[model samples]
Target: MDTETVILGGGISGIAANYFLGKDKAAIIYEQRDSMGGLCDNFSIGAFKFDTGIHLSFTSFKEVREVFDMTPYYTYSPEPMNYYKGLWLKQPIQNNLFPLTPEEKVKAVKDYIYKPVQADDFENYKCWLYSKYGKYITEHFFLPYTEKYWCERAENMETSWIGNRLYLPEIDEVLYGAMSSATPNRYYAQEMRYPKEGGYKAFLKPMLSKVNINLNKRAVKLDSSHKLVEFEDGSKVYYENLISSLPLPALIKIMKDVPSAVKEASENLSATSLILISIGLNVPQDESKSIWFYIYDKDFLPARAYYPGLKSKSNIPSHQSSLQFEIYYSRSKPLSMRKEALAEHLIRVIEKLKLANRKDVLFVDIKNIPYANVIFDKKLYFNRNLVRQYLNNLGIQSIGRFGEWDYLWSDQSFMSGKKAAEKLLNM
Candidate 1:
């Protein structure tokens, strides 16, 4: 098979690229999976349905809204919480310190009021955290939570990815939150939206109609020199222009005769793999009305968890609820226990946390996502740039979160594909 343009991976990025390229361009997308949507995809257990993880659309972009608004969705004010020492504090703990003990609150406020001067340059994420959040806040919350979520210490990670993701509050805001527990939601996203019926992938249904995708076409080898791709089923396709949304490392491995430096850089690129634990309940849950909460206690294996039932009523059966826990692991901090053992551990922890009871648990399911999020460690900039530059020179366009190797939401990923298609069309 041959085509003018070939897009590898039929995720939102690939779909968006082809959509923007127009049907007349005759771009073809090859996806390894039977279905599309990639990370935005969801799985079902009987009547219970859950997304790969927590996926909410809160984009302010007009282009993204125009596409996603095609589907029926429920808009909500984000009310995310954080768990610390058995106290439930609002999200952005720095801005909501009301749940802390009086002594702890005093120390946190004092540290913030007399925090160290901002440095000319931050050595690592740890340095940036201290310079911004002060000692007490960083040590008690941000530092520990960073290690749990990223599976790496803050000191070893880069600060480039922290753009407005973490809230930097005024001293008065912190003081007010410390005085009373009745504080408004301070999450970065003012409001979030989820599909009322279908899963998160439903938002892309409109775009999917405009693109051509071939499923179960896994590319095993690519001869960039000849502009040809060889799949596992012994099929070959020569392309004039290629756009790939494959993980950088996986893409590098399949390419024929890559430079040693580029190969080394690809090997150095690190990302977190997710073990998604989905639990269906026999009874309704109205206790924790919040969307999701971050787990700071090291005793809990999962970094965070969200209530899918809250996201949409159709996600569960009548009067039933469900929870999706996200446990992150990377090459450095590998999974300490097997998936089965980890699921059991998580169940027990959830029971102890009083989120659910063991008897009320209807069923438990596990899903492993290899490329959950890109790890922005100290070596990320140099290594990612090197590999991306090599691919660019080879006339390959890499888009989406994994392709670009950065933290991007759904809207950003969709826009990535559109931007790449535009670049190709202009050329």
Candidate 2:
């Protein structure tokens, strides 16, 4: 098969690329999976349904909104929530210190008030957090949570990508928000929105509706010298330009040939893999009404859990509810718990944290995401750029979260595809 463009991977980035490139451009998307949507895909267990993870998206940009704003959708005020030390604390623990006892609160306040001047050149994420939020908040919440989610000490990781993800509250305003659960939403996902019907992937219908996609055909080899691609089925495809939203490591491996330096860099790149655990309950749960909450303890494998029921009513049975949990692990910190044992661990932790009871759970499902969140450590920039530059020189554009090897949200990945499409158009 031959085309003007052979788009690899069927994630939002690839779909958006095709959508923006237009039908007349002779472009087609080739996805290895039976369906498109990639990590944004949803699955079902009995009558209950859940996304790969919490696909809660909030966008204010017009272009991003244009791509994602599907109506009959529900919007929520962001509540900064975290499961901390066997209790629930509003997020940005600095601002929501009221969840702690009076003594702990006093310690937090004293630390913040007399916080030391931070050096201008902080090396790691830990130092940066301590410099900005004070010692108490960093040690109590940020440290434990960062270790749990990233599977690395905050000090070991670089501070390249925490700009918008971590919401820092003012010192004076901290006590006020802490004192009241009624404190207005302070996090950036302030106007959180989700589909009213099925799982979050339902919103992708617009982009997928008219795109020409070849599913179940894995692109195994990229013969870039001849501008050709060879799939697992022994089929060949020639393209004028190649746009890949596939994971960078996987992409590098499948290329017909790569230099020793590029191969070494690709192998050196670091990333976290996710073990997604989804639980379905027989009873209605409306009391603890929040969309997403973080799990701070290291004992519990779940770094975060969200209510799928809150996203859409159609996700569960008439009297049922569901919660989705994400346990992230990386090569630096291997997952000690076996996949078969995760659900049981989740049940015990949910009750221990008082989030829910084990008996209430009617169904349990788990999925593994090989390439989930990309870890931005000290060597990531040098290694990723090296591989990316080589591919760029050969007319292959790698885009998206895993493709570009960065921590990117849904909007950023979608924009990446649009940018790649424009780059091709300009060329």
Candidate 3:
């Protein structure tokens, strides 16, 4: 069979691209898993629905907004709060300095209000923090906490990735907003939206419906030289235009003849592993009223935790509530020892945080997701540029979070796919 475009991986991007390109192109999406949605997929136990993570829609692009409109989602307006140092500080902890002690608050205000010594060059992530938030605030809040989450030293990561993703308030804006007790609806999607029925999968389902998708099909090999996609079952599919949302590293390896340099680059690109542990409670109560908690302490096995019911009531039954804990670790970390050992360690941490007691928790649902996020750094930039240059030369376009090695949300992925398809149409 011949098609105008062959999209690999039925993730958000692949579906969005196929939809934008329209039905005239005869687009076909080949997905490895039995279903679509990629990492955005959800699973259910009886009446309960649990997503891979708590995803909230906050897009800055109009095209992205339209893609979000394709789904049936209710607006989620949670006054986001943080659980840190035994206190619940308002989300964007920088603006809510009141929670801190008088001394700590005064120090933070002074540092934020006055500009630090300008650097000759924006050093590493840690050095940038020192210059922006000063040593004390950086050490207390940003450094250790971020390190725990990313599983790499903050200095190793690049600072350019922070562009608008992490809000940095000007000194005047910080103090004025804090003292006035006002957090303007200043977010890409500050008042983000979520599905009212299913989980993250709900949003992706609509886009997939418009495209010709093949499920339970894994692309084991690719003859990019001949523009052929080979599946695990020894089936071959051909395409004129190809867009892939697969991880760039793994994608590079599937090529019929990858250059030595390209293969080396793929091997160099690393990612932090993620394990999501979902705990359901027999009793119905909002133990952690805050939508999510970000922990910097190594003592906590999971870096962050969020309540599914808080995002949407559809996630759990009326009489029951559940919380999802996100634990991040490098594949090399000791915590990746064994599932049994990791689960025990996670339970102990929950007890320490007083988020739950042993008896209240009914069962633990553990999900280990590989390449949860593409690691962004100077090396990643070089690797991606080289890989993309090679793939582009091969007439293949890589889109979405893992495909392009770009740190973007599902909405961004959708828009990227749509844009890539539009580009193909113009061509």
Candidate 4:
């Protein structure tokens, strides 16, 4: 058998690469888990199906759209809200400031009209936000909350990742959003297409069908110089090219001999871990609204909440409802007092905030996923470019979220995988 290109981590990137590379390439994908899709997988208990994270499909690429067409799914009309500073601000907050108080609206409009200049060159995500939205708005919402979410101060992060992800509002639009009662542009509200049957895993199922996959096989060691990987089971595989979606730090550590500077660079790239708590509820969410909500209050353990059931019936058990709360923390942080204790705390917040109640909630499930995001710090670019150059010299290609050490949604992961496969095939 030929030892073709080796793809590590059976997430969207790996499968998409295989799809683009075609069968003649003899691709082999090795994943540590029992399944593919990585963060996009779904978990089920009884009749309720919960996603690993909020996996939504929206991209500008025609190829991405083509891949999305592989599944029969539901594209929702955007209806997102931000629960920040005790206010239920509409999504695209720049274009829908109705939730803000008169004073906040006035301040935001004034800031938008005459945006203040920042003194320093961008160093972190927070600094970038200040340059874009000014100090007050960043302080009131993006700053502290983003710090909580990423588990790092903004100054510790790089700002290049802000492209496309941060939507900048025009001055006229900001004023209109503040004055008008109508919602902002629904498209810019972060609307997305979701699977109706097996949840996000459904989208992955078909994409992965064409690829050769081996699950529960972790690549414990890598000899990228010779194009070889050693699995945990003592098995070995050789390849002409390797595409990795594993966390950059872990990937670097696995290499046969990494330089001191490369190792140090990898160390500087920190990431946020996530605890996804799911609540099955007896009461259905208000049918009049979409369930996406962002929270900034420290009291609310969740940085965000959403009702997947509201997106599609497949998300919930028969005759019941479901919602997900996203609590962001660092891996170094201790797990909450206990799972039950944490669940109760979240439930209490929901009740106190009038988002949900004990009677409405039937069950709670918690899932912890490390490396949810790549913290962009001051030396982020220097470290990232150094690592990239080193990897390139070794003829190793890192793709996708963790592999690239960048923040990217599933679409970007797919795009990265496709590009990497093309590069490998051409080589």
Candidate 5:
């Protein structure tokens, strides 16, 4: 079959690309799963529901907000917390330092005030954290937590991807926040919105009607010169234009007739795989005000977890709740794929922190996502540029976080898709 355009991956980017391309373009989305939404997809355990990993989404951009506005959503302001060895502080521990001991606060404030950070062209994520928050906060909280989450030391990764997500408070604010938990605004996303009923998929479902989506079709091979795609079911289709949101490495591997240099560049591109541990409880959360928390202790597997019921009451059954945990694992540091073994380990952590009593547990669900976040280290520019240039020269437009090999959230990926479609249409 022949078409004017064929988009790969039903993720937000591919769908968004089709949306911007308009009906005259005759575009179709080829998705491997039996559904659309890609990373924006959601899952359910009994009556408890949750998004993939987005505890909350905050976007001030008008263009991005339009998609959410299409669906009826609930606006919420959450006070997320952070857990250290034994003390609890607010999220982005640097800004909310009041929970620390008097002695600890003195050290943090001293460096935050007088210490001159070693400024230079950034070397890695570690250096940036040290520069911005000073040595005291870096060593105690920033360094350890990031190390657990990223699967590598901060010194080994690049710092350019630190989006508006991080809250770096000024000296006066830090001083003030250190004194009281009822401190002034410090979170980057002061207010966030999500679907009143469904999880992330609710916001995504409205956009699907704007595009033609073909589900359960996987792209096994691509003939760049012929502008053809070969699906796993042995179907082949030729297209005049292509917009893809597949992971960069997987995309490069599927294309026919690639150069050695391009292949090498694809190998150099790295990403962290994700393992989600969602636990349902017969009990309610003690701190009903907290939407989620940032775990800094090395003893825990979860980098973070959110109360699904807290984000939306409909996600849980009456008098019952759930906690969704995100634990990132890579080949470099793989966690037990065995569910029972992991359950034991995770339960130990839960009881240790008193998050959920083991007796209160209902059931545990484990999901492994092959592509999570891209590791943006020092070699990012050289390697990403090489692969992207190769694809662009061959008339293939790669977009989205995984497609472009960058650290991007939902809004950024949506915009990237729009930009890619614009680029192809203009051409």
Candidate 6:
């Protein structure tokens, strides 16, 4: 097969790139899976449905809004919480210290009031946390949660990816939150949106109509020197331009010949894999109104979890509720137990936490996603740039969260594709 342009990976990024490339341009998307949507896709356990992970859009990008508005969606206020020893603190734990004991609260406030002076440059994420948040808060909450979530020590990670993700409160704000449980939602997004009926994949339905995609076609080899791609199914495609949304390391491996340094750099780029445990309940849940919450306790197993049934009533059958837990692992933190054991542990912990009853569980479904989020460790900056530069020199444009190897939301991934398409048009 031959085309003017070929896009690898059928995720949001590839879809957006094809859409923006213009219908006049000849382009095709080759996806390894039998379906599209990539990470934004959802699964089903009987009538209960669950997204890959918590995928809510809070983007203000005009282009993204214009495209996403094609489908019906539900708008929700960001009501995320944090689970400590037993108390439920607000999403930004630093800003909601009222749940802590009186003595602990005093120590936290005092530490913040007399926190150390800011340094010229932070040694790592750990240093940044200690300097911004006081020693008490950092050691008690941030440090432990960071290790569990990232599967690595905060001292070994970089802070470049922490833009607006963590809230840094003023003295008065922290004091007020400590005095009372009532605090304004300080999450980065004022409102979050999700499809009203179908899972997140519905948002990209319109884009799917505009692009031509070939499912079950996995690209196994690339002859960049001759501008050709070879698929595992013995299909060959010759293209004038290639846009790749595959992981950098996987992309590097398939190329005909790569420099040793570039290959090593690709190998060094780190990412987290996810194990999603979806559960369906026979009855509705009224315990907590939070859409999602973080787990600081190591015994919980999952770093975070969300109520998929709450996102949309249509997600579950009548009088039923659901929960989806995200357990992340990487080369640094290997899974301590098998998938079945992990699922069992999650059920036991939730019951122990009194969030759910083991008897009410209707079914449990687990899915393994190889690429969840890119880890911004110390080696990420230099290594990622090196691999990206090499691909750029070969006239290959990489887009999307995995393609770009960065922490990108759904909207950001869409915009990445738009940018790649624009660049191709200009060229």
Worst 10 residues of 1 by lDDT: 282-291
Compute the lDDT of residue 123 as modeled in candidate 4: 50
- For model 1, what is the error of residue 363's alpha carbon versus the real structure, in angstroms, after optimal superposition? 1.2
lDDT of 5 by residue, 1-427 (tens): 9989999999989988999898768899999999788888888887888788854668777877888788888888767888888777887677789889999999998877765577667778887877888889988887887767877778888877887767878787888888988876567777888888888778777778788999999999999888999999999889999889999899999999999999999988878888888889999655454788888888888898888888788888888888888888776777765888887888887888788789999998888889988877678789999999999898889989899888888888889889988887787
What TM-score quantifies how close candidate 6 is to the native fold?
0.98
- Taking the tens digit of each residue's C-alpha lDDT, what string does model 6 give over 1-427? 7899999999999999999998767999999999898998887889988888999989899999998888899999998988889988997989899999999999999999888877748889988988888999999999988877788899999898999999999999999999998899899999999999899899999898889999999999999999999999999999999999999999999998899999999999999888889998888856456889999887788889898877888888888898899988899898868767877898897797777899988877878888888988999989999999999999999999989999999899999999999998887
Cα lDDT tens digits, model 3, 151-212, are 77778887777776556767766675556556664443457778888887776665665788
Which ranking of candidates, highest lDDT first? 6, 1, 5, 2, 4, 3
User: What residue runs in model 5 are displaced by over 4 Å at the alpha carbon?
Assistant: 285-287
Instruction: Output the worst ten-in-a-row residue range by lDDT, candidate 5.
Output: 284-293
State residue 251's C-alpha deviation in candidate 6, in Å.
Answer: 0.5
Please give the RMSD of candidate 1 to the true structure.
1.1
Question: What residue runs in model 1 are displaced by over 4 Å at the alpha carbon?
Answer: none
Model 1, 1-427: lDDT tens per residue? 7899999998889999999999657799999998888998888899998988899999998999999999999999998988887889898899798888899999999998888887647899988888888999999998888877898899899888888788888888999999987877778889899999888988998988888998999999999999999998888999999999999999999999999999999999999999889999888957457888899998888889998888988888888899989989899988868767877898897887888888888878887899988888999999999999999999999999999988988799999999999998888
The candidate, 3 or 5, that scores higher on TM-score is: 5
Indicate whether candidate 1 or candidate 2 has the larger TM-score.
1
lDDT for every model? 0.90, 0.83, 0.77, 0.79, 0.84, 0.90
Off by over 4 Å in 6: none
lDDT tens digits by residue: candidate 2, 124-183: 888888788878888888888887787788888898788777776777677786567666
For all candidates, the clash counts are: 0, 1, 1, 5, 0, 0
lDDT of 3 at 91: 56
